[model samples]
Target chain A: MFERLLFEAPDFFTYYNVIFLLEAAARTLGMTLIGCTVGFIAGLLIAVLRQSVNPWTLPLRVIAIAYVETFRRIPFLVIIFIVLYAIQPLMENASLLTIATIAICLVSTAFLSEIVRAGLESVPKQQIEGARTLNFGAARTLWYVVLPQAWRVILPPAIAFAVMFIKDTSLASHIGVVELTFSGKMFVNRGFSPLLGFGAVLVLYFLLSYPLSRLGTYLEKRLDPSRRS
Target chain B: MTHLDVRDLACSYGSEKILKGVTLSAEKGEVVSLIGPSGSGKSTLLRALVGLTLPSAGEVRVAGKAVDYSSRKSVRELRSQLAIVFQQYNLFQNMTVMRNVTIAPITIKKRPKAEVEALAAELLARVGMEAKHDAYPEELSGGQQQRVAIARALALQPEILLLDEVTSALDPERVNEVLDTIRRLTDEGITMLLVSHEMSFVREVSTRVVMMDDGKVVETGTPSQIFDSPTHERTRDFVGMILKH
Candidate 1:
C-alpha cells in the first residue's frame, strides 16, 4: 500500500474500483456541504438563544446547552445509525441521506454554537458601551459593532469545524448513504485490491480536509496582524 | 434651576458598591472636571449620569427629565443627547474614520446619507483628521484614533459630552494633539464633563473642578479657587502632589 502511491497510481486509474471511490468522494463532499449549511444556521440560532437575557432565555439556554453536551458526548457513528434506522421509521417519507444529513447537522450545530458564543463574548465591553453612548440601540450595537468583531474571532474556529465535519462525513457510510467510505467498501468487495480501495478512500478524505485545514491557518494569520512577527 | 442634577447616587455591582451617595449638579454648557486617584468612582459617577448603570439609590436628572434606567424609551432619548469618549478610544476598528463619525447619524439618528457624510467630514476636519477620512482605526496612531473618537461623539451632536481621560492613553508627544483638539472644543460652548489626570489641562480648561477621594466629593470649586486656595487637606495634598515636578 505504501509503494502503491509511487508505482501504481497510473494502473489504478484504469480500474473501475478507483472510479467508484472517486464518485463516492463527490457524494461525500455534497453531503458535507448540505449538512454544514443547515448546521451553521441552526448553530447561529442556538448561540443567539444562549446569549439572550430575556425571561425565556433560561429554558432555551438550558435546552441548547443540553443538546450540545449530549450529542458531543455520543459517537458520530451511533448518531448517524440511529437517525437513519430508528428515527426514519417515525419520520415518514424521509430518505436515508436526509436522515443522515439531519443527524450530522444536529451534532455539528452544537460545536458551532460554542465556537460562536465564545466569539461573541470576546468583543470588548467598551465597544458596546461606546455604541450606546452614541445613541445606538441594543440591536444596532450587536449588529454593527459586536457581531463584526465576533465574526473575526470566530472565523478560524468555524473553518476548523468545517474541516472536522468533512472528515466526519465518512460516518454517513454506516447508514448506507454510499459516501466515500461506503464506496471504498463496495470496491473492496468487488474483488479489487483491498489495499488500493482503502488507500484511495484515505486519500480522498485527506484531499478534502487538508485544504480546509490550511485555509483555517491562513484566516487566523489574516485576522490578527500582531501575530505576523 | 439646574441642567443636570444627581442626588444621593449609589451604584453597585454584585456585592461591592462602586459609587456611594454621589450627589452633584452642572449648569448648561458648563465644563466640569472630576479629578481623583484611580478607582475613586469618577468614571462610575459619569456612567451613572449617562444611565449606563442604574443607581441602586437616588436619582439623576439631565435637562428636565430623570433618566429612567428601567424604561427603554427614556434611556433612548437621554442617550441620544449624551455622548461618552472612553480613555481607551473605542472607535469601530472595522469602519473607516468617516464611517465611524457618520454611523450614529445614519443608523440611530436616521439621517440622509449626504447630510451625515457632509457633517462627518466637517467634524473630521475640525479634529484635523480630514486627510484620513477613509482610514480605519487600526491604521491610525493612538492620538489620531482618540481624535476620531471625539469627532464620532460630536457627529451625534450631543448636548453633553463625557470625556473619560481622553488623552491619558496617548504617548507624551501625541497627548498634546488630542488635548489641543479638546481645548479648542471649549470655544463651541458645548457642555463637557471630563475625568482626567492631566492636571494642567484641567486647571486651564475647566469651568469648575470637582475633586473626589474614596468615592466622595472632597471639594468643588473654580480651578483658581481649588488650585490656589486650599480648603481641604486632601485637596491640598492632591494639588501639591500633582503640581510638583
Candidate 2:
C-alpha cells in the first residue's frame, strides 16, 4: 500500500520530491503546533476574562467577546487575507509563515475561547455557590474549584478542535505558506499520476487528523458522568 | 454581642419579594430554626445571611461587623465568619469528602495545610464521616453528602452556620444520621440558623423557633410555645398543615 508513492509516482524522488514533501509536512505540522499551543493560552485568557462579571473586567470582557464573535463569523481564508492586508503597513516584509501562523492562531483563539467559555458555563452554579460559601472569592472559585471540573467538559471539544485545526492548516497554502497543500500542488504540476500523488495528500491529512478525532471520542466517553464515578 | 444579627432584612428578585423586612438574631450556642411552609422565605433568609442572595434592604452583622454585601472584600469577610450548608449539599463533585472539607480553610483562610488537614479529620469525625473521608460526593447517599457538607462548612471555623433545608433532600432512613450530627453541633456552642421541614427534629433541637408566612416572620418563641401552643393564627395554620401530614 505504501510502496506506490516511493516507487512509481512521476514526482517520486524528483523535483516535487519525497524530501520536499517531508519538509512541507514539517512546516505544516509546525504551523499547527504553534497555532494550537498559542491559541489555547490566548483563548483561555480570553475565556476567563470574558466570564468575569465586575466593572473592572467589563472592557476586557467586551474585547474578548468581540474577538471570538468576529473571528468565528469570518471565513478562515478571508481571515488570512485580512490579516495580511492589516499587518502590511506595520511589518512590510512579513513572511507567509508568519501571516499564516498569526491568522490560524487568532482563528483558533476565537473558537478555543468559546469552547472554554461553554465549559465554564456547563459547570453547575451549585458548584460555584459551594465555593462561595467556603469564602473562596470569584477568582479562586473559578480557578481552583470550578475549572478543574469544567476541564473534563472542555477536553473533548478542545481536542476535536485540534483535529479540525490541523486540516485547516492546509488553507495556509493559499497564502503561499509552502505547507502540505502546496506540496501537493507542486506534484500536480508534474502531471503524471497526479491522482495517485494528490490522493496521498488526502490520505496524509486523514492520517494526521483521524487520531485526534479518535482520541477526542474516547475522551468524551471517558468524561461521561456515568464513567466519572 | 450576638454571633449573627439581621435587622429588618428584605430581599427581592426584581419586583417580587422573597424575604420581607425580616429581623432575627442568634446568640452563640443558640440553634434557631426557621419553620414555615414552602416559599415562606425561610431559605431566602438563610441565603441572605450567607451572602448567597444579598438583601435588598437591611443589615446583616457577623460578630457585630455590619456586612457591606456590595463590597466583595466585605462580603468575603462576612462569609468567612458564617458558613452555610445548602439543601443540595453542593459538595464539589470533583473532590473527595476530605478535599471538600479542607479546601475552604486552605483557600479562604490560608491556614497551614497540616493544620487544616487535622481540623478536616476532626470535623469529619464529628459528623461520623471519618470512614468516608476519601469518598466523593457521588458515591455517598444524600444524608452522607449533607454530613460532609456540614463538615466542610464547619472546617471554616465559622462562628455561625446557616443550614437551609439540609435534611429535606435525604431519604427517610438517612435523615436521622444528619439530624444526630446537627444535634451534636448545637452542643458545640456555635450559633446556627436552620431551615428545616423536619418539624419533630426542629421541635426537639431548636433553642427557639420562628414561624414565617408569606415572607414575614409571624411568630418567634420557645419550641413548645411555637409547636405545642402557638400564638399567631398563621403560625398555627402553618404548623397544623405540616403536622397533619
lDDT of 1 by residue, B106-152 (tens): 98788998999998888899999999998989889999999999999
DockQ for all models = 0.72, 0.82
Clash counts for all predictions = 0, 0
For residues A1-229, what per-residue lDDT tens digits would candidate 2 score against the true structure?
A: 4565545665465664767877887888888889888988898889888877788989888878887899999999999999988987889899989989989999999999888888888888988988887877778888788788888888999999998888889888887888888888877776635666678678778877888899999999989655684
What fraction of the correct interface contacts does each predicted structure contain? 0.76, 0.94
Candidate 1 vs. true structure, TM-score: 0.94
DockQ score of the complex predicted as candidate 2: 0.82
What does the lDDT read for residue A158 in candidate 1?
91
Error of 2 at B20 (Å): 1.5
